[model samples]
Target: MTSPASPYVGRFAPSPSGPLHLGSVVAALASWLDARAHGGRWLVRMEDVDGPRTVPGADQVILAQLAALGMTSDDDVIYQSSRHAVYEAALARLTAMGLIYPCGCTRREIADSAPIHAVSGERPYPGTCRTGLQPGRGPRAWRVRMPAGVHCFEDRWLGRQCQDVAREVGDIVLRRADGQWAYQLAVVIDDADQGVTDIVRGADLLSSTARQQVLGQTLGLPLPRVMHVPLIVDTDGRKLSKQNGAPAVDTQAPLVALQAAWTALGFAPLPDASTAAAFLTQATDAWRLRWHIHPCSA
Candidate 1:
């Protein structure tokens, strides 16, 4: 669907750290089903912003995994690695607006004082580098000045959600000391640029929504609708991830893999389909009914 005509534009952005584990597939499948449910477009993005975490050839491998499951990007998939200039321009605008500043505090120094986030379990910065850098200290990174008040939005799955960005997240990093771009900045810019109208992802990212909403406001971009699906956890109750050594989805039997992912999305197992494509079609129809979404003309 074209940007203006599409009723919904969803995406699944996977980091090229390793491969698509079961958790990653759950997010990918949900985004694909939601896009199909609305007769909209589904795009894929490689979030290899952090070069250190990226593995060579991992992007293609992940794409292959999705293809095996009958999922593929609608448009030419974009990689964050190729969009440095755009991110720089966004940073420039925030700087021109006096909303971003150099952060000089090191992790050890900040960890000694800042409080941890309740839900996300991340240590919220205390704005130690907010006012100005210490006398002789130099800028190690850059941070957005979290404005006062709350940013609110309704998630398709989570209902009404709100977060005090200033208090809970504090000033967030836009770029790290190692020159790696921040996920928040890159994602907001990418989604706006790609005209993504809906975002269906894992619950682990739910906490980053308000921070992104505030960033989008600063950038004068439209906020996309979102739905966060439940995460697939391991025996230890931690979310499965590439970094956690979660094995790649076994694509040898595509139907079985697809059924497992479907069930993880809170759906009952579908009757055996002849092919992965057939299974996806059934899943999309069920997804549309579950979400009460009528097929859009686009």
Candidate 2:
């Protein structure tokens, strides 16, 4: 167990592209439970950097759903849209370090340039603009120059993990051509700014951890301990996501929805709890026990 004096901040960051689904609930519950178990502060961050995708009232809807589930942020909710200046400062710092450059390649250009052996399914940016932009091609986005080497970290659930960002992820975009802050850069800056010490989310984001870790290292920010729970997928084995048409969880019957999320996390449903508050208390207790028994303390 973490000492009371030790800082154990955790966060549940969700995009306002849609309402909270079962997948989102699972992630929220896990982060909430972890914060409770460790006697830490839990926060909610609205990842609405891409303004075009944000639904008008989705942030309030998401907050209401979490409240119905007996989970609330320890502090005021932070929206990514309001933090562009902070992100720009971080970008400026990186730019000053000569770690960033203008990217002139379009999606089609990268796809056409990628070699056949790119098994990662992502069209790795072939460093076409690493040296200088191609003639007549203006800058489309800003990309960070990834250094060559294996970046490794220990996941609380998945254990030891490693990835070569330079080879696999390539020069990732810091800002998209559309003038929106890319997720990779914004999330790193936000987590650090909010003093988030732990990140508990779905396994689908596991691949992104290494890239964020590298970016954090470059920015001299403290890396948060991470735990990626198994994703709740659909019948087709696809992870439930707004993009996949996963329906929003019922806020009106939040306790029942929480039960489903608990079950999805491999825990037996709490039969003794009647209300959302009682259920969350029981769930937090169960999680504390599991955390003590788990091999990775962080």
Candidate 3:
């Protein structure tokens, strides 16, 4: 007899710096719906990794909001702060494989070293610290050596896309100079260790998926399939975000928020589906039918 399949597991990892706004709600809803549709386990990762950026009581607020929205995650929340040992272990593995190195170059120094790429929206590191500074150097920030050649992937929502990691992203940081964990490192370790099967989030993270896939391959971690839905933007055409002051959705009216999210994703609203669970059921079916429907980005 064939072995039983690994159950589908998806997650909505939100940084607990503030309340869940429209865009966040959209992400949680999509991930939850996707997991439900596939009879999968949906988990939540409280990304309190960046302690400096975390707001007080934000974690509780986020959980309460998700509960109010009727988004039931499978396990008790997994906080990133508690997983440093796991991240350290992964980093050690990469170090053993000679995939990571210390970098002394600061942001200002990098900017001064090379012409920053304006298109990537972030200054691409110029490998100033790729080579070691003398032999017996002490601990400094760590950088992952991105593999060369074209890294390509078929996005579940955005079709065949490719990028040269060496050119586009350059060497990404695994650990920051300030001793905090980088998002790239933390997220990859968490997903792999947690056995996350799939990732469902907003389109804004589309490009980052490629980098995560590359990291996964290097570290021999299972690469989860990604589903990037369009972001919820304000009237200003800006994606609703905490930085933009997007108010958190009222958890009291979860069905209303769910319906709005479904409609935003181009799903036709059900006529009499009035409850949150019912809307989720209908929305998931609609979403599954539209899975891997890539956006035309020519």
CA lDDT, every prediction? 0.89, 0.89, 0.81
Task: Mark the regions of model 2 whose C-alpha exceeds 4 Å error after superposition.
Answer: 1-6, 116-119, 293-298
Q: What is the C-alpha local distance difference test score of candidate 1?
A: 0.89
Residue lDDT tens for model 1, 125-178 = 898878898899999999999889988888989899998888887899999777
lDDT of 2 at 42: 96
Ranking by TM-score: 1, 2, 3
lDDT tens digits, residues 245-295, model 3?
999888788888777877787778776787876777677667666763222
Clashes of each: 0, 0, 1
Sort by lDDT, best first: 1, 2, 3
Candidate 1 stretches with Cα past 4 Å from truth are: 1-6, 296-298
Q: Is candidate 1 or candidate 2 better by TM-score?
A: 1
Q: Identify the leading candidate in terms of TM-score.
A: 1
TM-score of each: 0.96, 0.95, 0.90
Question: Considering summed lDDT, which 10 consecutive residues are worst modelled in model 1?
Answer: 1-10
Question: RMSD for each model, in Å, please?
Answer: 2.1, 2.7, 4.6
Q: List the residue pairs that clash in candidate 2.
A: none
